[model samples]
Target chain A: MNSAASEPALIGLDWGTSSFRASLIGADGGVLDRLAAPEGIMHVEGGLFEAAFTRLLAPWAGHSDLPVLASGMITSRNGWVETPYVGLPAGGKELARAIATHQTTDGRTVHFITGLASETDGAPDVMRGEETQIVGAVAMDTSDGCFVMPGTHSKWVEVSEGRITRFATYMTGDVFAALRDHTILKALMQDAPFHDEGFRLGVASGLSAGSELLHRLFHVRSMPLFDKIPAGASADYLSGMLIGAEIAGGSAGKANRGPVTIIGRDDLADRYETALGIAGLTTRRAEPDIVARGHFTIAKAAGVIA
Target chain B: MNSAASEPALIGLDWGTSSFRASLIGADGGVLDRLAAPEGIMHVEGGLFEAAFTRLLAPWAGHSDLPVLASGMITSRNGWVETPYVGLPAGGKELARAIATHQTTDGRTVHFITGLASETDGAPDVMRGEETQIVGAVAMDTSDGCFVMPGTHSKWVEVSEGRITRFATYMTGDVFAALRDHTILKALMQDAPFHDEGFRLGVASGLSAGSELLHRLFHVRSMPLFDKIPAGASADYLSGMLIGAEIAGGSAGKANRGPVTIIGRDDLADRYETALGIAGLTTRRAEPDIVARGHFTIAKAAGVIA
Candidate 1:
């Protein structure tokens, strides 16, 4: 490996509630190296965040001068620095302007990216790290389309002119986990391979006109009881129903935003893609290393790295 | 208590999965004496249901000759006698005709009232205890209307000519509990007295046209964050949203089924009544002791008692 080609220019950190991931990005927008750990904001005991950060980044100690860009829940009220949320119509430049600087005890500087809040809708919706991912996605594709980030709390963001116009968050994955593991539906669910037919049925049901989710969820229980679907496939069916409902709710009035871009891991992105197809919408998966790319973009806009 | 007026004619047991309620009905179809315990079917150790029943009924051992009628999950597959479910368009007569008898160790016969199933809809739905409650409601009103039984799994039943024709189940309460206690929304919730305004706001949001539940639920977290509602009221807000969604789904096509009869305990029925009223549907509470009344009506229809 050529040392100059692999020289680290910026350290990007995606520090969320349950996991921590850091990337060493080269000046040419390439990933020099990457490291991840389970030490999220919630896991660091005794307010030892600075120590944890320093210890985790010890592998690239030779590149100590590289500017560090931190995002996710790490900037929340319970995190290392509580940054104010940037309102709608925000992107890399806006996030760069609002970036708060934290000085580590070791005389190093860390830039924290603020989250975005959507107040245009009835009730307020907010996202921390996903804003960066959206910025990264916009950087990859300059089109004005919607991005579906499927996760514990799936986000549906609308982007125009390389800035996030508005977005909505659906507790799809979180609710699915709670229902499948804690409710009466758990009795009928068994570990099984992905069932395509069950998922399609679920998506169709979720997207059905005048279908209420509370009623549709009970079908997860009744479907197996009536042998409409085998018990083993109930989990995936439940997944499809939730994802489909999310797409229905997220794309209620924004159907003309063109094809959706799914930004997440392949497994979940694939599920969202299938559910969106079932809902008669097309989708494309975003490139990998979205967080790292977002960090690099924001770092450049903030002038932290030149 | 006059002995003649309190003359026991039948023993009615509303035994369910998590609760056991037994009522002694007099010849005049009035409750003579009642007993309740936490010994639901699941609590009976080692399939010793007969022993538990005998011990629980030991208080009324002097009236042992009175025929006992058991309903609820006591007739389910996991109960003492696994009675098959009776199909739709069933009432007291149908339930009486399908009652299965089990001989206890002491040679006493316990008649288990079967549940009802609805296969008319796309998917199948079954109910064990609520069917008897509906029968009792029909006996009191004798009206062709809709019955909303709100509990862990809320049931909406369409009754015509004193028979349940079709019905649907919504996991409103169960999902509410799961989401409130186990999900990310739990962080913003605080236990407090019911907030009427918060509940009203939730109901209006839930009853909004084209509203999706997954999105509405996120408002429970956002409302507080945005200062639209206090943290203490979030619990009630969540409850109202779920109950309101239930009403939306339950009364979708049956708005003209006359006033909905709420068949449940006072607190839950009150919540359902409020949510239904918010959804522009009138509601009336069912009479207490509906289970005992149902048991007596079925016993008389089956000639188990004069």
Candidate 2:
């Protein structure tokens, strides 16, 4: 690594409910070094967030003057600094405007990036950390397109003119996990490598018109009972079905504007890519470290980085 | 009770996964006596189903000759005696014809009533015990209609000419329980009595056209987050949303032939009734002890009771 490029300009943190990750960013917005721990806000004991943050950043102790930008659940009500959500159409500027800051015990200021809330007419939708990624995506590809972010709570975001316009959240991953591990469907599912055929079948079924998820989920049990899908592949089948249903709801009423940009881990992104293809939609993967890019963007918009 | 109606004619058992109920039926199809215990098929230790059955039915020792007809998960693979499923269009006669008999250790004959399977041109749906209730409903009305049986796994049965033509299973209750108790939506939820307003809002949202269960389920979290709904009532809101989604899927493509006959406990039936009303469909409750009536119907068809 070049010595100049290794110079830390900003400290970026992606802290969620169960995992924490921090990245040291160069002036040119490249991640110079990174650290990860199971020190999510939820796991931080006795509210010792200051000490935990200090310990996690011990490797970069000398860079105390570097601006720190934190995102994800670390900015929630239960997190280190509670930041109000920035309502749509919000971009990095709006998020930076709403950033809540906390002065650490060590005289360091940590700027907690606010999340985004949808302005939809029906039930409201909110996100904690995904808005930063959305901003990063917009910065990378200044196009108006939809972003499918798959995770425990998958978010379908629509970005237009460098700002989030409207979005919806699908409990696809969490619901899949809950159903797979807690319901009768678990009895038929066995852990195995990802099964492509089973997933394709599930995606087709999930994307089928008038397909109801609650009803189709029962098929996870019946499909195995009838030997339509192997028991070991039922988990993948269920995952596909859920992701397909998410796509169905997520993509409804929107004209085929463009290929949806998928921003998620490789495994989940792969599943969504396959399912979206089955749904007759094209998809492209977002670059890795979008969260770090997102933090950089928000911090720059906040004038913390030059 | 009338002395004649008090005489036991058949022993009807609704042995399910988590609960067991046995009813003594009179020749006139009236329930003469009833016994229930926590001794579901799953709770029977060391596969000692025979011993558990004997202990639970010690009250009817003198009526050992009474033909025992068992339904529900007790006939499933995990239960005492596994019986194959009877395909649609199946009624009491078909169920009786497919009944598998198991000779108890005390020389008593216990007939296991097979469940019903849909012959639809897609993924097959099966139910172990709801078919009996559907048969009982047909026996009572003798009219073709849809039966919405709400429980852990809600079944929507289509009956025509006194037989189950087709049916679909929705994991509404099971999914609700799983999400409520196991997912993040549980965080904002406080266990409270059912809230009508929250439930109505959820039902209306759930019944909305283009409503997707996976997407709307996220509202359970966001609704509370935004204080659009009280945290305590979120559970009921989630329930309504799920039930409404179930109604949406369960009623799709079916012409409004008549009011859906709801065969379930009073509380769930009430919720379904309210949700179906919101969906602009009428509903009527099936009489109590449809299981006993079902047993009587199957026993009569099998010539075990005359």
Candidate 3:
């Protein structure tokens, strides 16, 4: 250890299935530089994880001894090392304890953040790295409300008093893939441009006639067997059917049932807001740099940086 | 025309997808003879439907011209003709009126059975020839309750006062096939005799941890990858997951949603009953011959036979 401790630098990283992201930050919380690579956990063997990560950070090799925090699949069972899920309503300290630290050849310390767990409507949702983003969003806004994070397994999170109160995961993207690829509805579609009409129809379908949605999903295939419906629009119709159901199911939850504050890229957030708005909920947009904000908030709370 | 208008013979036929059954009855309501053949709707091309049916019933040839009643998929949009679905809480009469009839080579009149439809828990369910079976089940037990007919698409129907009040369709069989054929779960299974312990464990997993069901589903691939769970039991586990959900979803309508009366072949019905029983539902066995019995009931009611 040096006498001045070399003024320890800080780092934040978001490591997902197919991609990796990292940022080098000064003690003042400003990004000095960043790096990214196609080194998501999925493509590499477990033993090669640490080496792959280190090579990606080699450009900023001077700060190799810096304190680094990582999130996402890096903590999954197949990840570098399993960082046990700390569970929902979990905050900075709990997640901090779950982090796995490793050393690069040059001596930098790496801390992999833990995922989160929460039970909603009797179902449990476990998210590996998004909790950090959620904390950042709340810290930036300091607002007690709902946060919608859209992805393959979309999550709607409720937060109050600076802690994640509850969350639910919907298999929206996976369901879309299954229906489009596996069902007869595939015959009725062409790769057409996206239209607000298609998405709007889906949102309404999900809310008003929500219960009959799944049953009608079967008819998507049956109707075209006869001359009742044209095949070209079946894919579009199926999309509406699923999206509608998801919007309705998400809103059915009990906590922070008030309004929603969506934190995501502009387009996704807009789409979510459009759907939720139709379902009669008020909405607001949070900054797009949610993961970074969450990292900053947690760092401050944990006394890692002022 | 003969001066006496010789009493027309009455013919009852069950024209299903894979096979055909014909019963010739005298005006006295006694079966004079029965014939079975492989010439079902599934074997013939669309335009060749009539020729196939006439060829199969050749043994009943030379019998006086008759009013022939048929049931099953032969009347679907893909079959002989489309018989419009009559919404349920319906009886044999409603189905009869919807049948599309045609004249055969020997001046025999053919009356095809229409399907039935109903709404439950805000979802619409439809059945083709199976409507006849429900009528038969009700005739066998007029006291009335819930009757479950298991097959490719299993149905749990509520019958009251000789009418099918409402019903729901569960994709239990189709899901089983998809999992067994298309998923990672397929890798774990073998053709040897199934272990009921594996089956029971799946059911227990679904019931007790029903809410976390989807999360567990995603990890099906991960568990084997990490060696946390065996690959061999994955198929059995998947079967249990789907069937378990079916048991829960199917029994939601009965009183305390009491035991369901399963009407099908002994083996398949027994499996369903056992699974549902494990999920805490009462189950009873009904005859698999419900379709044939309902055919006779309709013939008697039509005055085609005494």
Docking quality of model 3: it rates as incorrect
Each model's fnat? Answer: 0.68, 0.77, 0.00
By summed lDDT, which 10 consecutive residues of candidate 3 chain B come out lowest? B1-10
Which number leads on DockQ? 2
> Model 3's lDDT to the true fold?
0.66
Candidate 3 local Cα displacement, residue B245, angstroms: 4.9
Model 3 TM-score on a 0 to 1 scale:
0.76
RMSD of each: 2.2, 2.2, 6.6
Better of 2 and 3 by lDDT: 2
Q: Please give the distance, in angstroms, between residue A282's alpha carbon in candidate 3 and its true position after superposition.
A: 2.7
Interface Cα RMSD for candidate 1? 1.7
Compose the digit string of candidate 3's lDDT tens values, residues A6-74. Answer: 243577888887788887765545455667888788877655877787778778778766667788878
Measured with DockQ on alpha carbons, how good is candidate 1? 0.64
Give the docking tier of candidate 1: medium
lDDT of 2 by residue, A165-196 (tens): 88888888889889999998878778788899
**Cand 2, B chain, TM:** 0.95
